[model samples]
Target: MLKRKISDYLESYFTPNRREALLITGARQVGKSYAIREFGKSHYSSFIEINLLEDSIARTSISKASNSKDLLLRITAIASQPLIKGKTLIFFDEVQVVPEIVTAIKFLVEEGSYQYVLSGSLLGIGLKRISSMPVGYLTVKEMYPLNLEEFYRACGISDNIFSVLEEAFKAEREIDSIIHRKLMELFRLYLIVGGMPAVVQTYLDTNDIKKVVNKQREILSMYVEDISQYDINNKLYIKDIFNLIPAELNNPNKRFILKNLNENTKFSRLENSFIWIREAGVAIGVYNIEEPKLPLELAKLRNLFKLFSNDVGLLACQYADGIQLRILNNDIDINYGSIYENAVAEELYSHGLKLYYFNSKKQGELDFVIKLDDKILPIEVKSGKNYLRHNALKNVIENKDYEIEKAYVLYNENIKRVGNIVYLPIYLMMFIKNREIENLIWKIDLSSLPQ
Candidate 1:
């Protein structure tokens, strides 16, 4: 089994003298259940697993229990497993379907008989329906699709490769050409296979690109089915927007145009549909920031935004016929710039960065805006070879109205510093939050580097 970074956090959570019940939430098919099960088997003496969606007996028993002790007794009786303190781990998979089970979590934590890890696919939506949350009693964590680092590890890539990349990034130097090409090859595969555990696993098992794409299509179908099953009222509207993401992103102005969906469509009417898709973890929204400044959320123009699929591979699957082949063969002739931009957004979002973009008719559009310490860094992503022609980034930095210091331009290029702007390969977006790298970029004298 491939290791997930969340496993390390879970290990610490279940270490000696645990205090709170754990709640793991993420999108469907992202491997919440699998990761929990793996952690349980490796860390616990005895693991009891219950799927609320499949096991009615466990659900009824849990719902009927009066207190923590009663709930433990019911669970033990139903699961036919002994619950020993400090030795047992109880996993509740898909607990979002049962609101009563969620309510019991407070009592279960207070009981403290066994460590608990509760996981659900649609927990975000379920959280809205929850009347009383287990505040201050449960530790919460969100699991995303496997990131680039995790994907490389799953493919048995050496950690030395990443270490070299980190060194190059900190020094603003290019990596060895041979190593760079190898990493880029793996990155291309990542674009096709995505970071979805199921899709990644299929690719690993077969090494067949066609099989991987077929699995992605199935996952896309499952997302639509999930919408139909959960949001019956807005199923059509939700599906319409979901399916239109590729088209919306490919436009010159990447902001999702309401007119494209329906000329008469009002954002107010379809707001919930958008919320449902985002909360479900199937998509991420990048809002337009009218003023690019600190406290980005406050400056967001809610109605003006672009929606990206949660996984880049899924986006590629829906893009067009033979697009995957073009991407694989490096024969891409279409406007595939949005695909790389979407990948960058997906990576930054996985690292817990809220998505925002700055668009100005006068100053060209900036792909992403990130706040680092006291500085608001503008990130421009170029999928083509012309990475140096960043007029928007230059204009944004030069504007006296906005107090911008330095900017980052991500493209298919080696790491280098040009004036106040740093050029990085798109794959290195994963390291934007590294402490050492952040410090190096902030303190380095860009004047020392040749233009």
Candidate 2:
């Protein structure tokens, strides 16, 4: 079985401190069900799974229940395994088909008889229509596909390599040359293989890129099926936008032009299309910011943005066949700027960073700008050897008004630093952790006020 970081998150945060039920959300095939099952069976004495897709009768049972006790009775009747009080963890799969489960969970949670963990094949707008979604009663945590580190572990990379990599990233030192070459090869393979669990597993089992691409295509088909199921805005709007991601990303500027979706149409008509794709976790949008400054959302030009596929493997599969070989071969002649950017976007996003880019007439475009360590840190993704030739990054750093302290340039090369710019290996993006700033304890004394 593939080791996941979410297991640690469950053990450390959700298991010990779960006052509210947790709903693990992400795109389908991202391994939400597997993670939940693994954790529940290991942690609790009794693990009861209720899959709505398999048992349609549970939907009626969950909806008709009036109170917490009744809801528990209905769920227990449908559960596959024994539901022992206090010792059991009930796992709800494909909950989207049974929206009533969202309402029933609050009552079940209040009753406090058995622990509950819920997940579904789809998220975002799938749950949006829930009129009373037990917002405070249910906490939500998203699970992404196997990220770079998880992929490394799945590929059986050593801890010593990870330790050395972590140390070098922190110290701003070049990785050992031999290890660097091998890791770069692994990183390129990651671009083709991506973090999707099923796809990764296929590659791991067979050691074949052909089988991996086939699995990726199946997931893409599932996404298409999911889009058709929801019919958000218009089915065409969502599907077309999704299909256009690879081509649009290949554009010079990479900003998704609404006009391309419909030549005579306006963004007003197709707004929900983009919203659905984002909410569905089918895509990540890096919006254009008017300036590289604090409070990026306020300065965001929502209409102007770059859209990337949710997973890089799926993105590669969307392109022509045999590109995977080129990537694995470390092909440099091909224009893979979009692929590199997508990997960075997916990595930063997995780290819980909201993405934005800086573009102006005078200063060139920065691939990504994020609020990290309490400042706007611009990121530039380079696929070619000329990683240092970033004019836009220079302009943003040189500009006095932006007050940008430093930036990161990710490439398939060794780590180095020049002045305020930090150049890191693209694979090192695995360590871009999600820090907790919510409980920052800071208080100024007002007792010294002038009397």
Best by TM-score: 2
Q: What is the lDDT of residue 250 in candidate 1?
A: 88
Off by over 4 Å in 1: 434-451
lDDT tens digits, residues 243-282, model 1? 9999998888788988887899899998898898898899
Name the TM-score of candidate 1: 0.94
Quantify all predictions' global Cα lDDT against the true fold. 0.85, 0.87
Candidate 1: global Cα-lDDT? 0.85
Model 2, CA-based lDDT: 0.87
Expressed as tens digits, the lDDT of each residue in 1-451 for candidate 2 is 9999899988875554466888888889899999889998899989988887777688777768888788877877887777777888888888888777887788788887788889986668778778788978898898787878888889889999999999998899999999999888888889899999989988989999988988998999999999988774488889999999999999999989887888899888888888888878879989999999989999999888899998998999999988999988877788989999999899889889999998888999999999987788999999998887999999989999999998899987899999999999899988776566587788999989987
Please list all clashing residue pairs in model 1, or write none if there are none: none
